[model samples]
Target: MTGHTAFGWRTFLLRWSGEWADSLPHDEARDPDDEAARRARWLGFPPASQERVTAMEERLGRRMPPSYRSFLLVTDGWRHAGGFVWLLAGTADARRHDNESELADMYEEDLDEDAGPEEWREAGIWRRGLQLDVRSDATYVLLDPEDVDEDGEWAVYTWASWRADAPKRYTDFGSFMEAMYREFHSLRAHRTGREPAFVNDTTRELDARVDEARRDALRGDWERALKTLDEAEEYGRPRARGLGDQIRRLLGRTHLVYFPDVVTDPRYAPELLPPLAAEHAAHSYRGDASLTFPLRGADDALVSQVFATLEQVRAGAYRYTAPGPFGEAVDRARELARWGDTDQAWRTLTDALPLWRPLGPDHLVPLGWVADPVLGPLLTVERGRELLSTPRGGHPGEAPAPTPGLDPPGLAWLVDPGPGGGRGPYRFVLVEGVEPEDLPARLGDEDAEGAALDAPRTLREARWHLPRGPRESSSYEDRPVMAVGRAGAGWSFAFDGDPAPFAPRRFVSPAASAAAGTRAVVVWSDLGARRGESFFHLSVARDGTREYAFTCTDGEIRRTGDIPRALDPDRFFAVPGAGAAAERPLLEAVAEHFGVRLPRHALLNGRLHTVTTRSWTRPPRDGETYLVWSMA
Candidate 1:
């Protein structure tokens, strides 16, 4: 009957780490025996008070919500009534109760986690925990899910409450419902969705407002509910279930706000409220991390941005966080380290060294190894040379400037050990990683549009700038960006669009087709943008030989007569003097030798010329030769 006393409360108050449900008030604010008070005290019912126990159990059978069952089993918030108080234990309260709540609640509720319904039946321990409280007019015990009567469907559990103590049991919800209907004509079938439009109760308007807020919340109308819940809370007043928890759970699920700091505070626990002085402290830990900086400018800007983001991530400060992009960036960095450009990888390592401090050892050390696989051995040698200031015999200065022009440069081997005499097909294949600045100058025309991104690129960066080719849009929203068409022999050249004129710098070449057979000879002409809309000619030789020629000019092989005159008879069919003196022209040559008339205007006045020469035999041991020329 006093401010600090538990004079009429059923359960004693105790401090818990997290939040704890407050004890429900029983009779007597001193001895007040109302319906709500009866339900509140039902938990304290003793085994001898069967009538009170049975009534409370029946009332509970009528009022619990459905999702509570699933959430209870999964989270652990079990509880039971004993004497004048309820004893609870379960998963939902594990963190708060040191896992004790789980055992007490489960046992009192007759929930045998280890046994199924069939097992419980076979073991005959199915008599649920329905205890009676002899002192009260009514008391009840809640039945666990597994202990439910077989005929009960919608009614999943039972409880008891009584006007006075007696020994009686109800096997089904029907028995409880029949008793309730008989005693109180007000009893109605509580079909969940069939609640009437209005019930003439003093709290009807308040209930409507709360129901409306709940509906808004379930529909993800957070902003609307936020506005409405203020009014709903006022209406629900002192006895209402806290709307703050619902709001907190919703906001957390939507990730629209920080975790439920204020609502989850102990003040909302149906008891004393505290001032808003308390604030949660942040939890911080260190581990490896990766970062991607989206820099859109020149090379220097790119490098600086990349370095800065890496630095910040290393410093353990970031906003709007998610794990996926960071993980992907780390993976990409690892892959980049695997490339042959050990020096570049080293530079990357040096740039990102600051971030490595926060990362765990596994990520940091492996990153270094990835960046410089040879560094371990080099370290051993370098360790031996304590005074690195002394001059070494073979000191190579700065590396030579890259070769300029049309051809992509071959990969350089600065300290290769001649493969250490290893012999395999490894000699034929090559891997080249070109610096962005050197790439366009090496492959595309000087005046070509949209060639600004010549540096190294992230996949995101590449998607933003690359042509994406004719078959697909540049947006790259489609599922799989990389695809291999059906294999075939002929080569197919694809362009992002009808390519512009060669422009003295840009030119096209046929790509190797999907097939591995004889390649198609592609000749791209109509070279000017006007009529030269990116068309190509397929030149197939009868002898299974082919040649691809891309040009912007017409040629001199105009008439059949000009074909013979154009043929270089000395090299056409006759072998040179040093080798076999005479030999028939190769079939491709025969076509050229016999006077094949070229298309009209098929000449480009000195537009193209053969840039390479091939010999079928050793020079002095001469063999028949074929001519390649460019004409206007």
Candidate 2:
């Protein structure tokens, strides 16, 4: 196992003749015709005589490693080992390569210069390494003289000229040759229409073992099955390698990397790809070219087709699409995830998954990416109910007309620790006639927006301005930091300043005054430690007037103007014995009464348009604490 693979390579190479390598995936730059011609001559030259090996060893004044010696005894040289390397030299050509010194220097230069002279001295290079291949296309195979093992085996390297990078290293010549053997099968695995190949008796046994392992996996004996597959991979068994990876994917040990044949193989993919893609996208860097998959989660026609195929095999996974961009729900997911509310975060994604669309008509990637790393850990099974439910997708309807003073039922989750969504202290004004996109400019995002226009952010990452606890009171923190974005038809302007949003409290009037035409509904809830410990402020403002307002601070209540018919002072203050003891139920009634809704996902998760309005002069009587939450 150390010198070369513990297998009969002589017999294996014998069967790798004629059109055997035809199934291998071709390098894009190479000619298919030329590749086929080269592959037709897969077998190596005849075995070298012992005397010839001895003479070559004496010329180099070194004893050849056991693996290379055995390889030459089997065949003097070989042609076309893997995707690269057209030839492997025999003893007849075994000598110091002409450009060995230059190649070694370049390889050494690729190392870290910051390591200093002591570390740099042991660069582990081969200035005159024995070259082992010929006619190679910018790819060299060399053996390092200084990198020998206890078994007298010299380390081998496969380097290329085009890439100014480090070479791929191997333990010995046999290990390198075995890598080529494995690469052959890996390249061929990309194609279809060919049955599995069996090269020798050992390969036949490997095929049998892999088949047994698959059966064991289906029987829920995955541990044993995985062990068998792992053993088979040591011999470069392709079936075992793929099956092991797929099994690990199911066991949550790895990702599939990409979609395989779901229809033909049809086991691990259909049941999991959608959720897995979201999970993958959630964990990976946003907008990375490698992670870019078509955002087709909303394409009902194609999604239905895929779900139907999965259904035939009894696989069940939901596809999610939001009323608008999936990023809204994704934002909510990140927010909830940061709060350690994983189950709700997951629900946020799945509930918003019903409608998705492909980037193009011919999009083939099974699932689109979610594109948010903050939401990565937001996955879990909720007592199996989440898995048991029927999956649902579809587009959002037209935004409902803004209903001032009404809190949509969804807002109840903000204070509840239950499965319902939860959030920190929030202050907002829900208003109509204010464009969601326009809020950015109104909120002083002109600078941020201008910067954004110059260089847009990644698709998956949303902005969060939450700053908890006592910290720096810098001027940046001195000014208000609010995220304004669309909430259904209306716009929600939420503040994330130190502790709270408004400093003198009357500042809420100017914010609501910014609304055009109709009056704005302003709401603020004090940060709470327990369920009913909230100090809430509910106000209706029109052009600088705090018309019809109710305030509950430190258990005291105040009301001004003609209270709207929607008023319910008892619910806003909370009544423990009234069964409306919890802040969540009371808030639910408050929201229901006002009939206005804000997408909490956008406020907490989305990187909405933020701004710092002109600061107001604090009248001395405004309060001793006029220096409270103020944005720059």
Find the candidate with the highest lDDT and give its number: 2
- lDDT (Cα, 0-100) at 386 in candidate 2: 26
Kindly list the per-residue Cα lDDT of model 1 for residues 488-508, writing each as its tens digit: 111111111122233222222
Q: Write the per-residue lDDT of candidate 2 for residues 450-551, one digit (tens) a residue.
A: 212111111122223333444333322323444444443344444442233434344434444555555567666754622344566677767545577776
RMSD of 2: 14.5
Candidate 2 lDDT (Cα, whole model)?
0.52
By TM-score, how accurate is candidate 2? 0.47
Model 2 has a clash total of: 29
Error of 1 at 166 (Å): 41
Candidate of highest TM-score: 2
